[model samples]
Target: MEFWIIVALTSVIVTLAVAWPLLRAPKKSTELTDDYDMRVYRDQLSEVDHDLARGVLSEEEAKQVRTEVSRRVLAADASASTSAAEIRIDSSRKTNLTALAVMAVFLLGGASGTYYLIGSAGTADQPLAQRLSALQTARDNRLSQKEVETRVGNITEMEDKATDDYKKLVAKLREAVKQRPDDLRGLNFLVQNEARLGRFAAAHQAKSRAITISGSKATGTDYTDLAELMIIAAGGYVSPEAEAALAQAFAKDPEDPRARYYSGLDLAQNGRADIAYKVWINLLDEGPEDAPWIAPIRGQIADVALMAGIRLAPPPPLAGPTADQIKNAANMSEKDRRKLINGMVRQLSERLASGGGTADEWARLIRAYGVLGETEKAKKIWGEAKLKFASNAKGLGLIKEAATSAGVAD
Candidate 1:
């Protein structure tokens, strides 16, 4: 009741302030007119008399000046009445009143019309509440369905590196996963996208759920991904849980590149460099030449290999056996094929480190280092190559590309 009273009072005040001009009648101005001139003439006659009494003017001269002034005043008085009447504009007065009424209608009508179009008047009695509510409603309506999904529904939406299209895909995947939480396909997307999105915690959770859903079908890659996520989530520290995940991955696929790489890393940290050396050297011999993990393997393998009575070779150029090469060696066993590949890699590395290859070759060597996850070695090579090719723009460009690929560019 008090609110209503306040509102009613406010409305009355606004109405008066807005329409006062239309409601009031026009008043004539109190300016100098014929009547005023009569008074002014009388005052001048008195001043002339005072001047004569004080002997400032001769009696005759004062009288003559007063007479002339009186005559002019009478004429001015007649003109003043006409001038005053001419200023009274009845037509203009009516026009102004009408215009004021029209303006008041527009101002009040606009306010009411705006309220009716978007206001919550029909829903509630509180007139002021709609103003705040409208703002919130507008903001809520601004977000597209896809935007909402990307911001909240999908874990991968948080990844800074993900493309907008990719983020949308992740959002759709999130919706699908929500609908079927037990689906392996959904969980797989959840794992991969989440990791790519850099949300390691979510990635680990998704990987765990995936393993649970997959049961015995969960592959080494899945477990490895989970372990890697765990390591990342723990800020590169291989926690006990990560250790467990790594073991599980090894159990499923002992030859998994990432799994073997991380295992070697852990082993080296645990003062088992000899074992780590064996693990990495074997990975180099069998793993895909372009694998991301191989760079790190090739980089750190040297120290451990030396400690384990083995020579760690320099990184080879980024190349692997061609289909033709494999076909030519088809008569050889799988072990032989791998051995030949490893030997080729070893030969290339030796040439890069000592045989003084071309600028392109050096760049290839750096790229190979990157592929093997040997960022430090790649950086070192980059420094040396810069000195060698400082004046050569083409060579420098190649080296820059290689360094960038290796994750070693300054």
Candidate 2:
């Protein structure tokens, strides 16, 4: 009977010990009072001020003495407040708690030993499930702690690697551009780095060289990428060339949303509100059917239309792709495409010369020069085009002629 009682008591104690941690509120020491020393210092400061005003010291001596006292008071105040409240509370309370806890542990241990020696001669077996549950809980806690540590370490390593690689890439790009001043690839890399670092103006300057290199033969990818970067660099300020490039790229691959959308933006930037409106109208009419780009394109078209004083109806149903549209104008029988493109160039140039050109029109002139391989002349004309035609009606009309010429079906 004694042994049975002992076993029951042992089980109860074991159960309580296991249950205590789960049921107990976490132990937290109270926050400590801040600035006890500051309170004393403040009292001392009041005393010094009183003494000074009462003529206990001459004014000059009081001033000097007050300065030194003030310094000491502030130092004492800072010292009292610097340690965190939580740390101070833990230091003060843990000492007392530790002593009581040690006493309780020894008492409990003694009672357990006495019961085992005198009251129960046989071992009290625990259920396998309970024992397994305890073991699993302990294992899970250890694994969770280890996993957190591992993940933190990995994140730290990744951060260090990223920083180092970024620096190396920047250095390599600079060196490459310096070695080969005309290297578009190097300039592109530098531009990419500048953009990443948010040095947008610098990126634009670097990207300009790449744009010049791309010239008339700029691939669709090249034109689109450069235009996007240029806008970001300028915080959306663009020249006629940027808009023209965007338009030409769209004419080549109307299916590309980014090219089509930014082409409208470029037009608006260079002060060709009318042509921009029309370009957007065409974009909305001709863009990929049911594409995500349609809404924004429509929105931009509406805005530009408002500015251009052009009331646009809903865009017309898109015409199906024509063979002329699909065939590369550049690849056409050299005689045929060249004749068409040349006729466009001559007719547009004459029109612009008769009056002036729009930003879009200027872009068309540049495109004509690019297609004709007269890059330097194209450049000279583009530079002068904008300054000459701020808002002349003839200038915009000329630009419309240029657009029609450059964007003609193969």
Candidate 3:
């Protein structure tokens, strides 16, 4: 009610200001008809008489000058009378009260209607400090990894799709790790196989053990892997435990993509979509298209941008294998699929070597070599990327993230 009252008052004040000129009586024309001009003509007539007395002008000349001055005086008087009559007529004319009313109504009604339609009518004012406090409270109250997992149910269904040989291998690996619990290599293998089989809880446990064993030698990737498994286990929720792991990853390497992506997720879930949107948008723009986080970031970024009060367009699709080509590869033999992948990798490598592609493309090449178990090539590419982006901190960060994922970064 108070808001409406203030708005009404303001509108009235503005309307009065705008209409004030038209509301008052018009001033009489003050130009050319004042007594000053008549005085000047009278002085000219006196000058004519003085000139005649001093014999400077003939009698005929004096008579002619006086006649001209008198004629001008009469003409000016007539113009002044006509102007006064027009002024009187104007003053007597009625004001356009209807137009004034319409203007006032439009100003008030238009503004009120616009506010009612789009403004938050009756919602309590939320100051910056209050909003920040609320976000902090939400963060403090967020669900833990265990709680989220319970809500989403167990995520071990991928084990059903494992082949018999793969299952036997994973089972043997698990036993091997059980027998030699302190062996980091065995633990790492167990974590990979468990995650492949969709036993994310077990995978994260194994990864945590490996990180503990490695201690000071553990890379950011180790903590990132642990966080990734936890998030997967919790059905994509970045739990408190996962956030802690991501923090550890950042402590090791601030450029770690997995850690950065998960941290952004945590921020978004805790009601800081503005910050999250910046993080995710940068990650998407600087992507090695095959980064594990790319697909998920792409999927959620549009919605996140909207939440942050941004109208972002979806990024153009990255150049890659088409749907038809991917479908064809699915039916190919393992060797054939590997050959196709190798061909694609070779093309990217050649492009980067000859044409000097973007930092993201270079990163993609390094990560692809890592995927193919060509660590030597990945390391060489990582070295070249460092030199190429020597002066560019952001580009180096992006490339370093891929190198870390490829096990080639220092």
Backbone clash count for every predicted candidate, in the order shown: 7, 0, 0
TM-score of 1: 0.37
Model 2 CA lDDT for position 137: 60
lDDT of each: 0.69, 0.59, 0.81
lDDT tens digits, residues 307-391, model 1? Answer: 5687645656456677888787888887886677557656666665543455677777788777666676677788666544433
Worst 10 residues of 3 by lDDT: 386-395
Best by TM-score: 3
Q: In candidate 2, what residue range of length 10 has the lowest lDDT sum?
A: 152-161
Best by lDDT: 3
lDDT of 2 by residue, 204-290 (tens): 567667868767766676677766655544334444445555766676676676786676665565446777777666766675645
**Model 2, stretches more than 4 Å misplaced?**
1-168, 182-184, 211-217, 241-260, 269-274, 289-299, 308-410
Clashes of 2: 0
Q: What C-alpha lDDT, on a 0 to 100 scale, does residue 383 get in candidate 1?
A: 66
Candidate 3 backbone collisions, by pair: none
